[model samples]
Target: MKEITIYLFLLFAGVITAQTGSGEYSIKNVDENTENSDFGASFYGEKMIVFASPKKGVSLVNEVWEENGQRFLELYSANITDNGELYNVRSLKGDVNTKYHEADATFSKDGKTVYFTRNNYYNKKLAKDKNQWNNLAMFKATVNENGEWVNIIPMPFNNVSYSVGHPALSPDGRTLYFISDMPGSLGKTDIYKVSIEEGGYGEPVNLGDKINSPSKEFSPYIDGDVIYFSSDRPGGFGKLDVYASKTDGSVFEPVLLNQPINSNADDFTFIINPNTRTGFFSSNRSGGKGDDDIYSFIEIKPVEFKCAQMITGIVRDKNTNMVINDANIILKDVEGNPIENLTVNNDGTFELHVLCETPYTIVGEKSGYNPQSKTFTTSNEAGKITKLTVLLGTGEIVENEIKPEGLPKELPEEIVKVRPSTYVVNIEPIYFELNSSYLTKEAKRELDKVVDLMNRYPNMIIESGSHTDSRGIEGYNLWLSDRRAKSTVNYIVNKGIDPTRITGKGYGESQLVNQCSDGVKCTEAEHAKNRRTEFVIIKM
Candidate 1:
């Protein structure tokens, strides 16, 4: 009994979010017929695609070759309308179709040269392997002056003992990629490429460990630097799954395309038109019209990074309802570490980036107005911006106190007494690295001033608030901000201040002083303005 190889794949399963361009794909059967297995589609001319099918037709039906108990595959063409609908299905004309199997074809850019896979047959004789099974081979044919595919010649690498099929050409037509179980293969069936030159072909080079596993890997389709193929290696959703790998020269890293592109059955032959982002792939999964059927897909518009979550808002007076220009605003994460500090614009508006799914606090203050703070949280949705309005009560300006020098002209020193003894000190923004809460040397230097203040006023109690830019996952940013806030408090405690006198909280990207919310593009400097650390007076 011939042992049938069952190719299965183990894959990482997770909920596909909108950001990875996952949910936008809509798949449907492409003019499928119930009787035969139809698959392996490649672009043919302007409005048609060529594929292989084993269904009975008018041309000729010879002896049946029972490999999978199906008739020999033959090349067929179908017209695709402007609306991406498939129609006018028929067998390819000329002498291309023969008694032996013929399928898996690729065309040159000019559509003159066609390379395809077929059973090894020369002069009405079948080439067989040691097991009495016919081995597959590749052939090339060019359009002759008579408008027919003539002079069919076998590829130089074809052999009677082993199979070499599934031809794919590089964009420049200088390289041919194919699958073979011939000598020097790392897997049962591996994808290999040979350099195509003017004379013939160069050495067949294995794609190496990056693309091939101990299992089967075939059906390679190249579009620019990205190569889409089918593999049965571990970590897939089914027996076979479609995968994509990007190549920088000779290096490749395969990434599995999760469902609905892949299913729990054999899925292969993925080809796409890069310009339209529309393509076709074949699968034998249930619900198809036949054993194997072609499915079409179109990419949804506006692919976005799911991590880009932000918050933006403005500050206004309590009664006047007017935008507060140049008002000092501080943002903090849930753990109470300062994330950013900014002053409202001349129009009483400010924008700050914040992380998603995190709680934050926005504090707005002026020298004479009553200091105000509001706490809110962000959501997990990408490209979502949270808006806010801060109302501060009017108050009288007090006598002079020592102010930090070289502060931005827009941000003046604010001294608001919380009690007869304690006063709020509005400090400069404290910055951290992207996606990091670890304190930098600059951060240490800035915190040193807070240490000095705590030491000078031994009875003072302070709250450290941390904030982050809206460039990462909200929950993660909140956690990072919490760490940052605690790090700040720890620094002060290490400076001989009692730990009980200081507390830290992280306020994620719930408050923005400007329009730098999710889906809004901002510069690094602008995002830097949102990541800040602040110290607020609690008691004295």
Candidate 2:
């Protein structure tokens, strides 16, 4: 019977992942009801969850169907703790539970109306299909003044020949999504939705290929723009991997979630709280207490962006082309207020953080070189770095003089032609952990300096070259290095540097600086030298 098939799928479709978003999560079984299956959980109230369970001696009705010697499914309520643990489990009161089946209940936004799946049974008579087995159907109920569900009625679309169940309501309660095997379905079972009007329900419309594959698609849940569901189609971790898709009107293209959300087992019936970014789902995967158990999860947060707008470059002697170390670099705002006094590094390089969309004047001078000043503006473009090369000439040291208020300063006499100097400076090598492109704290700190340099020299272009240790295969190392290079560049770009000013390349183990090549034993430090990132000036 179709009801039997649906129950069998619920028992088998078990899968899960521990985390889903910007925070770490701990998942655990709701309770120790290991002897019987418990799943298809949905939020009941603020701190309670209503789920379907088939534990022995819990059903109130006598006309129960048995599968594997287990009682038919019944709706139960349980209180969930803040830490995602379940306790105080009990069955639903009033006339909601029956002998045939009652499960997969979803509530309206107000929690006053409930739509659920169950067998078509009324007045102690079961609605059976041609094979003498009952067919699954959807029903609705509303809470009365006595806090009990009254006015229970079967959906108008229910039929004995075909099955229609798994009801999920939209946030506004204006639309309902469900799974059915009625005529014109794309597969054995496909998801269908209908508009709920004040008068009655509209005709069921198939969700189409974007959602319903030739393989069965069911257990539809919507939160904001995303629709979460389960599918047994190809390219999944197992028989039924939970999938999510961004809903654009009536269309959706689902993407299969990776482990540990999906395993080599069936998983379905997912529900979540969008505000807390946490929820529960059922999985028949290994390491559970029951045949199918409800597990809670929270999503893990990702790395935060910390890089800021920066400028960096070297100060050099124009005639001699020598690095000018310890240069007094003064940065001033557009109104001539001193912003910062920078100390040039030994390599004649200086880096400074600057505000975007503001103009600043930079004055660089060594004890013996003439003071050189340049004016530039930081653009509003994000993640861009400006570069600059201050070419100071040999001349009589100029003294700081204060002019009379409102007086024009004297201009310097024209000097003979002086050639601009050019020199190469090696940046500190960026190190990474083995076989990963993720930016380490140290790596980010180092790239922050580069961001300052690129911000200072707006017209300068740089190349990020990354290499890997020789421990892995050359091809794999190359791929890893490529990702590392891009990762490094992306970090700098995210700091407000222009992406066009930088490029990345991976050398793999082909450009080792030491004797840590393949087939050669070397110390970890030696191999580490090869796994490095370098920034070279490509254009100025």
Q: By TM-score, who's the top model here?
A: 1
Tens digit per residue, CA lDDT, model 2, 1-540: 344535744433333334331123456666645666788898886788888887356444443455555677788888888888888888876678876678899988787888888877866778888788677889899988776876788898888888888888876678899998899999878889899999999999998876887877878998754578888876677777788764443222466665666667778888888667678888888898877888888755311121234677777787887888888889999998999998899999887777656798888887766788877775532234566777788422222222223222432221111111112224456888888888888877778877876675667677787889899877579779989999998888888888888888776776676667778999988988888887755555
What tens-digit string does per-residue lDDT give for candidate 1 at 316-401?
Answer: 77788777787988998888898999888888877777665578887889876899887776554333444566777862212123
- What is every candidate's alpha-carbon RMSD to the true fold? 22.1, 22.9
Clashes of 1: 41
Provide the TM-score for each candidate, comma-separated. 0.54, 0.53
The TM-score of candidate 2 is 0.53
lDDT of 2: 0.73
Q: Alpha-carbon error at 46 in model 2, in Å?
A: 2.3
Off by over 4 Å in 1: 1-24, 58-62, 249-252, 301-540
How far off is model 1, as Cα RMSD?
22.1
Against the true structure, candidate 1 has what lDDT? 0.72
Looking at candidate 2, the ten consecutive residues that score lowest on lDDT are 414-423
Error of 1 at 239 (Å): 1.0
Global lDDT of each candidate:
0.72, 0.73
